[model samples]
Target: MHQVASQLPAEAVASQTRPLLVLENLGKRFGSLQALQDVSLDFRVGEVQCLLGENGAGKSTLCNLIFGVYRPDDGLMRFAGREWVPAGPAEALDSGIAMVHQHFSLVPRMTVVENLMLGQSRGLLQHRAFAAKIRSIAESFGFSLDPEAVVGELSVGERQRAEIVKCLMREPRLLVLDEPTAVLPPDEIGSLLDICRRVADSGRAVILVTHKLAEIAKVADRVAVLRGGRVVAKAEMATADMGALVRAMVGREVKSLDVALSESGAASAPPVSAGDAPRPRALVCDGITVKDRHDAVRLDNFTLEIRAGEIVGLAGVEGNGQSELGMVLAGLQRPAAGRFFIGETELTEAGPAAVTAAGGGIVPEDRHAVACVTAMSVAENMYLNKLDRFTRFGLLRRNALNQAARGLMQEFDVRAAGADVAFSGLSGGNQQKAVLARELTLDPLVALVAAQPTRGLDINAVEAVYRQIRAAARRGVGVLLISSELDELIAVADRIVVLYRGRLVGERPAEPGERAAIGALMSGHGL
Candidate 1:
């Protein structure tokens, strides 16, 4: 029997051990774009190396190259003192390298155990043995997962856990995780960080690719900042503050939105509106209840009213019915009970088209799934929902569409070459801006939803989005903002509501330093 030590004491080892993985002069190019250029870094064993960058800043590209999704055009990867070039994912796995992609790659129909064992060596195909191994590994990592559960039936956090287990099952010497906590709730995120620490404690190296600076502060041992496809900064986590890190990533001075708000005189604004401020009720949900396929209530007894000229923020951990609630509000799905009213029109059963036609706009959480068609041109995507306005009878007026697209591009300050460019060619921040421009141009009475709105965006772009949302609210458009980032919610929302296990657990007027209270509520504690 293998008897591994349960814990390693502080005095047990030397600090000068060689790194487990090293990249020297890594360069990768795709057509005209140089995704990664002459990047170099070393990942030490039993350490968490945090990689931070803005969208399209070559963080993902570096990960893809390291994991063998794309080979580096000019680079040398050395693992355990041996030169290595992984030809593909399979080869990478065989060479003790494993990567969990930012986007899920599991087949929904497959069982958890099946997905876990999918790419295992042929010798481990025996069902009983494979299941046993998966369970054992899951237990070791403090992950609770049902081997027989289908991937489609699992929550987002569970699915992520399964991915981690799959990587662990290979006994990888170096593990690469991309945006692993993007879908997790705050409490669950702590658990994930614990898992990462435990994995490293087991004498393996971990590379965490994320944009969240707070997570880096909590868990990273060392950090590497990438900007414009190059490693701009590398330093010990203890020696870096959030301000310093932000400056390193963006190459500019950093200031919190709160500070900016105070400087702009928004801090003196009244917490709750009073007097004759139009008091227009834009959105109302009357005792709404939504059930999933299993007849379980995903949203229960949910009653809320969002007034025009206000932003209502929903704060919760993932899988607390935030997605379902957002979908229902956006009219993408019907509520099982009660009704949603836009002005006086009941929209409980209204389809997406009807809701959109009623001056309701949506920026869905899953961008690729609901927001834009990646393969289509920016102009075509811009006119997707408002095509009829630009079209004359049955034929599309291409010139009008292009004209509108160009106008929106200039208005939103979307940093793309032209409207004719494909949506996929733009960065994530730019794509989100495009979607926002399209949705807001309709002059909607109620802008239904936005999830993680500022995620993957640089400071300047995030500020632009904030300004747009604030302007919309000022124009008497009710806005619903859903995000796990408490700082964001507090920055923009007039009111904040916490969701816990499919129920509205708490509500508070937005105030400074109220995040801790809201976070407690989100974790199922009374505030």
Candidate 2:
């Protein structure tokens, strides 16, 4: 591993309290991209320090460097008055530092206790004692997880609890959490924040990486905003607010969802009439019931409709049948009992190809897995759904494909080195943009189903996506937008529908001050 002596200036090191962890002038490079440059920070014991940034602003890179996932190219690190350079994650853990990544690392086939004890120098049957100890610690943090339950059988929230339990079992001095609350419900988010607070209060330092500005107030003692591989701003939570953070991160002002929506006047539009001749039903589902591969009910009698020239937002917590509903609408999965319609034509069991032929577009939740091919070029992936249009006589036309891809890339502002670059080389926001450019550019589109459309995007990219979705509605294409963010639904949707446990429980016009009511319904309370 790369190692260097202390290059941090004495004044910078002396300006803070005795720090448990210190990083000075840290730098990392991935091929041509400098993921981190001259980054410096100090972490004190018994405090929560939040790392705030856009998707590609190098927050994860810093955490990975500290945790021994990547060796820094420059700078030095000191921990507890000693130079600290861990060769790997095992050494980092041995030095009392543990990490809970966004994606959990537990073995799915193992039980909770078994997974936790995998790396420990203990026999297989010795997990019972460990399980009892973990159960007590988990209860103290108010997380209810069965020690004997298989990891695969737990819910997302439960799995997070198990991950945290695994971390605490090691009794680490410094804990790092990356976007821990991204998939959690509002109630679970409160619990997770409470857990973080307790961990910090017990003399352990916590580093939280997140994009949600609102979460900073709940647990952050200090906040650092990163932009363009630099720490643009840092402040104590007592004096910092959302506006200041947004300005520092993006170098400009940004309006909140409510304020932006109010200025746009989208919520004041008149409701669509069912009998309108010009705007007919573009997508319709009648009493759809679906089950997953494990024979669990995902959608129970779910029904909805979106007419042309309208944007309907589906709001719900993650894993509450949103994925199943999107799959059903995209014709990727066959509903057990339901009749789907695309502009008055019933399509009960049509596959993705048939749906695409009928003017349907899809932006899947897991974009890399379901939407794009990583090994393919950007130009090839752009025309994935409509290959025949660019092909003739069983021969490929590279020039035509590249030309069309370049035009759409320019139109959508897809930042890439070139059309022939690998699709995996693009950033997360640019990948989403490429998907949007391909779908929205399709002619005669009847319905567009977008799942988690703005996930992992920066604020600017999010604004671009909202504009494109609205523009598609104005172009006489029905749009079904599924998102976990209630504020996003309130901002861009003409009408919002709440889904709970595979059922549509509430529907309301996307008006101001409706978030509270919608949030209640999402948690199984009455509207």
Error of 1 at 162 (Å): 3.5
lDDT per residue, candidate 1, 136-162, as tens digits? 876765556788888875666677778
Best by TM-score: 1
TM-score of each: 0.86, 0.83
Q: Which segments of candidate 1 are over 4 A away from where they belong? A: 1-16, 109-111, 124-150, 153-155, 261-274, 387-430, 456-461
lDDT of 1: 0.78
C-alpha positional error of residue 174 in candidate 2 after TM-score superposition, expressed in Å: 2.1
What are the per-residue Cα lDDT tens digits for candidate 2 across 1-527?
Answer: 00111233444334234688999998887777787899999998667899987766788778878899889999999987898888999999999999987656788788998898888975555667888988998787665678988876555557777888888788888998877776565666777888787676666688998777777888898999998788999999889877889888878888776565456543332455678555688899899998866688889998898888788889887768887787787787789898888887777788877887788889987676478897899999998887788888998798999898999888877866678778876656677889988888776688989988877676766776787777778778888898887778888888899999989999988777788888888888984
Worst 10-residue stretch by lDDT in candidate 1? Answer: 1-10
TM accuracy, model 2 = 0.83
Candidate 1 has a TM-score of: 0.86
